[model samples]
Target: MESSPQVYVKAPPPPETLGRPFELMDHHGQEVTNASYSGKWLLIFFGFAGCREACPTGLVSMGAALDALGGEAGQVQPLFVDVSMEEPDITGLAQFVSNFHPSLVGLIGTRAQTFATVRDFKIRREYAMANYSTKETGPRINHTAYLYLVDPDGVTRAYFDHTLEPERMALTVRLHMKRRRTSP
Candidate 1:
């Protein structure tokens, strides 16, 4: 099911929260951060690897759109930021992300740290299946998909939904790049 635009959460504007930076492991278990992504446009999204529908389809659309971007996509980075507690370490998250978009990088961390980052980005998730943890009530994690465009300066300037039209997403990214280049 699709969510109303208004019901969707919005990430804070660029540089809004320098916040507590977490050391998330990438696909290779290499260290990465918001700072490490500087100097390139970032298409940062929040969702889990196990999400059966929303996450996979959304990413497929994103990758196809970026591929259509041709060489311009070289300036863009498609990032998979995970908040799932199933991942025990960075390597796990890295492997999970690599399974989809080979070029896509995955970032994973402690629940507290991951949740904090998600909160900063205004990402939202919901419990789906029975609780996997004995202490928790439910099992699987079903997330609300959100797409965030973080500029080279580390500012989140554009936002869209999980089911955002591919053509529109492409147009939006192009327009953003154009504006940034022409700006004083």
Candidate 2:
């Protein structure tokens, strides 16, 4: 028996997340809870900063999509979570994350903060490269490259798997917002 290689996926036409709750942080180091997004849909990506590719690419596409959404995209809030716990200090991750997507914020606190947030979302991360960690010193993390879309009500509505086409992702998100607008 051998361990399976970790893989990352782009937004893969995830189901609709019309009503899921999520409590995450904003780029401004503010406390952004699920309640904070009570009236808007959310596009959330849980990834690390040291990521060589997927992290930046995903956020970049996501940002572009939001920008493309124009006024409609205002209803959507995109988020990024740093799964690294090697150190309480996330200066590296923060700096790295912000560089890609200025609006894409990174979260950091204690091991408990990471655990509590990740656990609630049912997200998991395995440190493969052990060179540095927010919780320790050096460690590469193994995390799924899936994005979770939560509804305004703070409920799990859909999941965009890895390898999701950018146009499709942006369209899907836009569609969700359009549907929300029509629904009473």
TM-scores across all candidates?
Answer: 0.79, 0.74
Model 2 weakest 10-residue run by lDDT: 12-21
Candidate 2 residue-wise lDDT at 175 = 76
Q: Mind giving the per-residue lDDT tens digits that candidate 1 earns over 85-115?
A: 6545565565557666557887777677677
lDDT of 1 at 128: 56
Expressed as tens digits, the lDDT of each residue in 78-114 for candidate 2 is: 7777776656445676676667555565665456766
> Candidate 1: where is the Cα deviation over 4 Å?
1-22, 87-92, 129-138
Task: Give model 2's TM-score versus the native structure.
Answer: 0.74
| Model 1: lDDT of residue 15 | 39
How far out, in Å, is residue 143 in model 2? Answer: 0.3
Of candidate 1, the 10-residue stretch with the lowest lDDT total is 13-22
Cand. 2 Cα-lDDT: 0.67
